[model samples]
Target: MVDSSKTHEPLLVARGITRLFGNAYALSDASIALCRHEICGLLGANGAGKSTLSRIVCGHLPASSGEILFKGAPLTAGSARDALRSGIALVAQETSLAPDMSVLENIFLPSYALPGRLSFSQLRHKARAILSELGHDHALPLDIEVRRLSTAQRQLVEIAKALALNADLVIFDEPTASLSPLEVDRLFDIMGRLKSSGKALAFVSHRLEEVFAITDRVTILREGKTVAEGVPTAGLTQADVIRHMVGRDIGNVYRKAVSPAVTNEQAVALEVTGLHAPPIVRDVSFTVRKGEILGLGGLVGAGRSESAEAIFGLRHRSGGRVLVGGKEIAPNSPIAAIRAGLGMVAEDRRTQNIVPDMTVGENLFLAQMGKHRGFGRGHSARRKQAHELISRLGLPTDRMDANLLHFSGGMQQKVVIARWLLIEPEVLILDEPTKGVDIGTRQTIYELLREVAERGIAVVVISSDFEELLGLCERIVVVSDGYTIADLPTSRLSEESLTLLAAPRSSAERNAAFLRDLVAGHGGTAFWGLIDEDRFVCLAVAESARSAPMGLAAGHVYLAHETAIPLALGRRQPGHVTESDGRSTVLTPLSNRRGHDLGWIGLSLPAGSKLPNAETLSARVAGLFDTPQDEKIDA
Candidate 1:
């Protein structure tokens, strides 16, 4: 769709870029060109030099060897400030904002380097305008501390900071990782505006659909070298991109073979009853059966990761009972949890899982060292098993002595996972296990996880990728605002329904308050839920004292006939439908500004009670989420 002939001269160019970390090359002989009025997509697997090149260009790190030109002149930047002054900016994948500072302060952080009298009022006005242009004016509070914002909100700040510089060349690295669908769309629109303004942009992402939607030109990298440079985006397909990224054809990633279902009689491998960790995790509870793969699904700050940490003893629990293999384990002690047949692979692999200074073999045996009682490293006892796992994971034994940091991100993640597999625990909890892994390696990890589950180890995976959760898990637990909202079989849920269920408690609270008002005003029971044919999934419920029970509760699934208001659920019309149980029910569909369905809101009243007009009630439900131009659906 991009007219290549009419394009202006390139804004920036890098040739033969090379970056080395110890003995391994993170980027080698990589070249790219970004022209004005176009968005060039940087495509690659994890550790494919995309981030390395972006950093080198932004002066985050000096290239080991390379030449870069900007505006037809040799560009030399000694620090990030130099790059900023030169009209270059980068929105890093991992947020770089200062947590303790206010949103306003972080947005104008680059301005602090400018030699001039400081003006907080001027900076605040500019920050507000930038956020407004990005369609997040009220969503971000200028005075609020960055630490209190969620991951998605933090990413917005990063974007605003980059925009504040009005840089000629801007690079966005995995910017959509923490954003919702609506936010992603808004970001794309902003990028379009930037391109129209003749600002060169580079989009770095693993999401193929997004690449196809926005990119004008694409550059693919593998290992550390550029495989395909400056190829037209319209000429390539998803398969071609994947092939170039992984250097081979990768079949369906989720290759778990069908297996017999585990009965209810099967022993519970891990159970958390009334799990409570203040401010993050509250009243979280779930059960994983032996050989079953269960997914914990939610948005970025929904306490899914915190719940896993609490269950595995990484975080202190105010009150809860963790049972592993039918025996209660002590809280707030990772050592005791591991000894009790529990293992956890933390979310942040670099800071929490990998020891950069240690050898690959040593990192692999670190968990074994903790579990072993012997004074020596105790690695000798597990060396044979370690070797076997390495072979199974397609890793070479000769590289065992190398530093773990020298390997690719996928290889590093495999080593971290192998460390846990060495312990051979009954329950394994992994948070964002495939966060930065490549597609090919992702398939391998999926197979490995399936094999682990087949071997009778209960596997709990916490992920923000809804498609991955649905494809890999038999059941899913939806967490929102630290509460376990719904537990349903994967067969009965879709990504749309999961997104609605995983909506933040702030959004749910509004709907809950509306339900309460309905009950108080009408003297009946009101509920919010999703309905598909004969199935219904309740999200929240409120009832008046005089109202009769409807046999419905929150965080539950039921067949249409199982509830007292079956007729209303079966026929989801806008008007009231009377049920056989002498209850009158009204159901109204809910949607956001983008027309994304948020399921249905229903009210059930006794046959004799006064009823509000159906049209008025529907308007009230719509009014709850009907913002003028901003539809902040807490995905």
Candidate 2:
């Protein structure tokens, strides 16, 4: 992974890059620098030319006028071949996949351009290893056509393609858009590995939190110009980055309702009971109250989209009870679901939601076209509703007849959500609503969803972004292996805690088994949780000694002073600490081999129970990290 050029200078530098498409400028004076062993974040709003700059650097497009130095040598403009040969690889935002090509073939597509003896067997093995490392051991089928894959699956292929190159300088452009928190962690680990191996990385993303988390320095773009160049990311705040990207201050768009129209106790607008769809979905159940934004949170391919499809009637469900306003509705067809007051913006927009040949207005009222299939067409009323919605949503009234594909991905998603709102359904479900959208548009959509709930419409949002779920929703239902395992309020959750809650059942089970073994060896309750400051978030707990019966449960957050074992929680040292009430405890910190904080594992015993050695407990806890994640206790 080391670059042969052992210079102390930056590995790659693009100075005053400018590109023009006809009379308009796509980029102007945009500059960025990527250094070896460091990740430089390339940031901008939706149309801010970050992608344009990345393409130019990777030789996907010819720079109208600019200078790029790779390993202190000038890079040939607009020559993808030359760039690849020079060890520059880009995982593009808009994928470059051949529809008919298999996943294996598509991953190594860059290789076919070079002269070499083909070894399909070696490439296949490498591809499998890459996918496995990406946490998709059996999810993506190598033989399947790229066209048949989901958006998230296709994104994995994009990542694999770049990794296959083993390039010296890698550019990750919106690489985590479709990946969940769990999967993103895996990808970040790989990035860390590359950085450690002395390779350079340029990470292009709109996610500010991610930018701060993974980047060492940042380059900000505004209106195709570099506003901030090579600034230490740690020294810059989120506000500073936003101002640079948008040329103005942007407040938090994830604003909660000051006075909500409805509460979780008010009324259930959408309820799915014992939902069962073969294969992907086993059993999923949740209830969304009027005016509540409920999040469906989980890892990618953990049956979240499948659960949504099953509930919306897009996928056939073998068993499930759908209820709207206390009345049972059948999961027969999408039209039936719509008629029963359900609206859904599916995950796949191009295939499942949009019609490329139709005008934006036509597609906006597409649902209306179906609901009134046999009845008299109410053209006048439909037009009135469309106009009002357009004004409210700030839609393009001037270009109503324009093709839907003419809009950017962000605008297109906004239009899709608007269409569902036009029908005024009681329940509206959006799957990965912010997927592939930039930061500014993401904020707008968050506001839109908040507004939707304010109007007394129940909102169910499925997303891979853990922070989005915590910010936008009041409650989150965690799905793993197609089952709704934990239902908890957002107040008690953090991105770290939610990740733990959404872990796959097998991993969770292993952790739980480890806890059980600890309880069997000792005479007390064993629990796993994150202990930060005064807040203690429990992820899993197993009790074998009912005499102790610590009222602690999973998916709950407790303050240090409020718990029965307050002394033990407060101490949180490497040894056992006994409380005033004589309840003894042993605590140990746990983390994976990668040095990720997995939180603390503790054992609590009744007043007179013999305490085990602290070192012994630590050794047992270490085993949890060595194996798969332990079970998430049912909330």
Candidate 3:
């Protein structure tokens, strides 16, 4: 939909850009162009030079060869200050923030480039406005330190800082990596507004759905070279992008066997009951069987990482019970956890997992040391297992002596995961294991986890990425605002249904009240949820004392054929439709002002009960949202 013709002047251009570190080339012959009022997607697998080129364009890194033209003038390489002064900003994937500074101060950090005098009061007001635009006005405290914020909150600060620059050209690197689906929609709306205002934006992410949703053009890099440049996004498919990214037909990323994924009959490997770690983790309970890959899914700051920490003894539990192999372990003792056949890879890899100065081999054996009796540090004892793990992980054993920090982000993650596998723990919990990894490495990691599970190791993966949870996990336990809300099989859930199930409690409570109101008026089952072809998911439900049961429960999924109103659900029409059994149902689609589908609200009546007016029900559903949306049935 963008005017890609030469009529519009390009806002930024980098052609044949190359960068080298020692004898290795990070980028080679990379070229891309950006035009005003357009969003370009920079797509690639890990080690494909996407980050290298982005850093070069934003002046964070210098190119060994080639040039960058910004606004028809050459840019000074490696001069971030100059780039900022010239109206270009980068939202770094690994956040670049003063951890000790307050969110308000960090938002205005770029204001130092201006020649005018500073005003803290004015900057505070401006920061609030910027966050308001991002739909997160009150989520972040101006006085809170960045070090105390969650990963999602910190990413918001990075975005706010870039917005504060009011730059003509802005490059977003994995902006939505930590964001929820609703938050992602909000950011895309912001990007659309910026594009409409004639600003040039380059978005870098491994999420192809998002690229297709927001970008007008695509530029793909493979092995440090540009394979496709400035191709209209409308002319490509997800398969096309994947083929270009990995140079092969990467079919179904999650290709588990068609056999039933339920490992319920296996012995319990890990179980947490009433897990209460004060403010962040409360009332968390779940059981993982041996060889089961269970997912703890929620938005960032929903206490997923905190729950894992508490379970693994990395955090003190105010009240809870953690059981490994049916034996309760003492709280606040990580050593006890390791000896009990438990290993946890924390969310922040650089700080929690990797040691920068240590050799990769040493870091790989770090977990083994905790499990061993300690006179030897366990590296020599686990030499054979270490080599075998590295090989299975597709890591080069020759590079074991190299610094762990020198590897790519994907490789670093692999090393961290491999470290835990070397101990051969019964329960391995990985927090956002593929957070910054690319599609190719992501696929490899998925397969690796499957292999680990096949070895009878219970794998608990905590990830903010909903798709990753749905793909790699057989079952997902939904956590919202620190409570374990829903535990559902992956087969019964859709991304829309999962997002609704994971929505924060305020709106969900409101929806509950709305459903109650509907039930009070019509005297039948009223529910808010999503319906797939063969499955139905309930987010909230209300029923009168005399109401007939619709065979649906809150935060649970059911097959359509198992419910009494199958015919009604199959219709999904705007008006009320009666089933063959004489029950009646009416569904109204829920969407936002920007036309993002929220889900549906349905009212079902008993066979002989008086049905509610379809138009009246639709109107009520529309009024439930802050903004009035035109209701339409999905099918």
Candidate 4:
């Protein structure tokens, strides 16, 4: 037992939590504490014992040998009743609600087993009241069955159920994984309210941004043990957290794809015209240029994957025309797509991409059996291919013959990518290519994608990452509400711009098309582009401490780096740019002799900016002088 004499005794505590199955260790000596009114983030790649630890904590699974304590009192593991009675509630990735039961019943299901007779009328009143308190008035019907609710509504029902349990410690497992931004904001509001009410919460999510936004402290687990714990969110970056989790630095997630030179004889790789998939994908038309990396950007359920499936013939299309190299191709069948020189890396890799029980070698070559003389006899060749892929993808070579299920989620995702590569298709569709992969493995996958694109393969990538689109794609097609709203050049894409595009718009806003065009036009500007907080630097430099937009049009508030003085300045601030080579240059707001405040002019006289440049940026900045002194500023 911990020294309870400490004033901040944890509401819930785990000590030496260990769970193992046969020879495979799942959770080993894992322990963490949750304090009242605190939100702790539990982070790790998939299969890093996050779920296992959560299960042990919530009493869903027995700790092989360990103890769970509630308010410093000894508690039993693997007892659902004990956990509920002890005020520990868990909302898993899969919402737990009776499909046929009303939302009211779902929220009060835990307390229904009490000694008193069930009262449906009273329960409905309480459920409605709770929903109202959670800011869901009339949004979710109390009497409506859970099966009819949207994914976000169902998630709220789960949260409401947890809240109704009066749980001291509530665990949310990827609650926003599939939610829209508005839904996510609503959920966060609910969480914030819960925190204010002195309740403890644990949020487990794959999104680093959400973790930073919602969590107070973070605990990162790796390979079954807590590698880092109680790490504060302050002064720490996403790359820092990912480095601790994956044991490597991966701040540089973006990579420029070198365009392959197209010969006049080269054929058009992929063509789709008026493709219509009812209810999910609407009339969409686009062409995948030969050897080009085309990116599809959208929110979840925006039909990015559905379009990919239609292209790959996995899902039925109501109406569409597809052409491979100018030759008309039939649809509604995956085999036809494969035959037409196309391959797909699916979104849900666990179920859709890989055969878990199969060995890595078998999974890699599963789609291409014709290349082998026989199935069993092809092991040697398959092994060679698997070894090559494993090496190329930085996978563990010794685990080539091992069951794919035994590999980590990151490694499994890599295997999924490798499986598709064996087909050597002319056009490849990768949906959420790095879904659950860690930073290091994600880089390897990006490199692999580049290699494939270099080989004259028309790559169509569907990603939820706006930054990724800006990085890997020459152009991005934004999808929303089953419609292709805009096709934007990679030159005009940013995280903020993509967010605005992915979000749903009002009918009037939709018809205007001004926001979309504005985003597409000005998204590529380098605002807030200088700061790289991943590295340790005690110093920051600014020249005159005045601001005007550098690459943007609007002005913003400014602050002195040393004194932290507040000042209202334009978007582009006056600053002395300094490089690591000790060369100091200055940027002064240039106006004509009339002092009309023409855009700022930078001189390579002495220094660089306060932000450090890790790359060989001196030469790049040296050419900035050649740029026109006055560029038309956007309003």
> Which is the leading candidate under TM-score?
3
Candidate 4: list runs displaced more than 4 Å.
1-8, 45-47, 80-82, 93-166, 179-183, 257-267, 369-382, 505-635
User: Candidate 3's residue-wise lDDT over 1-635, tens digit each?
Assistant: 12244335888889889999899898989988999999999998888998889988888888999978988988875588888888889999889999999999899887876798998998899998888777676567899999988777899999999998989999999888778776787788789999999999999999888999999999999889999888889889999999999889878877875544655678999989999997788789999999899998887577898899898888789998999999999998999999999998887777788999999988888888778894778677679888888887778999989998778788899999988888889999998888778777888888988988988899999887888899889899999888988998898887878887887665467668888888888888988878788787877888889865766778788887888777766776678888887888888887655566777788888888887777887777667655422211111
How do the residues 1-635 of candidate 1 rate in per-residue lDDT, one tens digit apiece? 11234255888989999998887788999988899999999989877989889999999999999899999998899899999999999998878999899999999999988998988998889898888776577657899999877666788899999988999999999888656454576789899999999999999987787889999989998878988888889889888899899877887787668888867888999998999998789889999999999999887667888898898888889998999999999999998999899999987676679999999998999898788875887777789999999888878799999888777677888999999999999999988787666677778889999999999999999877788899999999988889998889998887777877887777567788889999988878899988977888888899998766777888788888888888888888889898876788888898766576888998889887777898998899888876644355434
Off by over 4 Å in 2: 1-25, 28-37, 59-83, 98-102, 138-149, 196-198, 374-380, 384-388, 391-394, 532-536, 545-553, 556-566, 578-582, 625-635
The local lDDT score (0 to 100) that residue 630 gets in candidate 4 is 15
lDDT, candidate 2, at 207: 79
Segments in model 1 whose C-alpha atoms lie over 4 Å from true places: 1-9, 19-25, 63-67, 94-107, 120-160, 178-198, 213-216, 232-235, 532-534, 559-573, 576-584, 606-611, 626-634
Pairs clashing in candidate 2? 507-629, 508-630, 508-631, 509-631, 511-630, 512-631
When 2 and 4 are scored with lDDT, the better candidate is 2
lDDT per prediction? 0.85, 0.82, 0.84, 0.66
Model 3 spans > 4 angstroms off: 1-7, 258-260, 546-551, 578-586, 605-611, 626-635
> Residue-wise lDDT of candidate 4 within 1-635, one digit each (tens)?
11212125578878788888788998887877788878888888767888788878888888898877888788864587678887888987657679899888889988866677977887778787777655464457787898766454677788789877878889988776545454465578788888889898999887788899998878888878887776676656998788777877766666555465544466679888888887678877777877778898776556777788787777788898999878777878777777778888887665578887888877877767633444464556556766787788877787768888877677788877887787678888888776555556667888888888778888998876666677888778777667776676655455544554564323213212322332233231122112112211111122222332122221111222321211212223455444444543333342322233223333222222343231323333333334332111100
Q: Which residue pairs show collisions in model 3? A: none
**At residue 106, what lDDT does model 2 achieve?**
98
Query: Of the candidates numbered 3 and 4, which has the greater lDDT value?
Result: 3
Cα lDDT tens digits, model 2, 1-635, are 00123234798888879999777687988888788998888888766788889889988899888898988888874588789989999998877888799999999998999997879999999998888778775678899999877678888999999999999999999899878877887899899999999999999887788889999888888778888888888788998888777767768868765874455478889888899988878889999999899999998767899888888788888998989888887775888889889899998777788888999988888877666656776456778778877766657788899888756576688778878887889999999888777677788788878887888889999998988999999899999888887888888788888887777776566667788887888768999888877778877899984565788887677888878888878877878888898888889998776667778888888888998889987886776555432212221
Ranking by TM-score: 3, 1, 2, 4
Error of 3 at 361 (Å): 1.3
RMSD of each: 3.6, 4.4, 3.3, 13.1
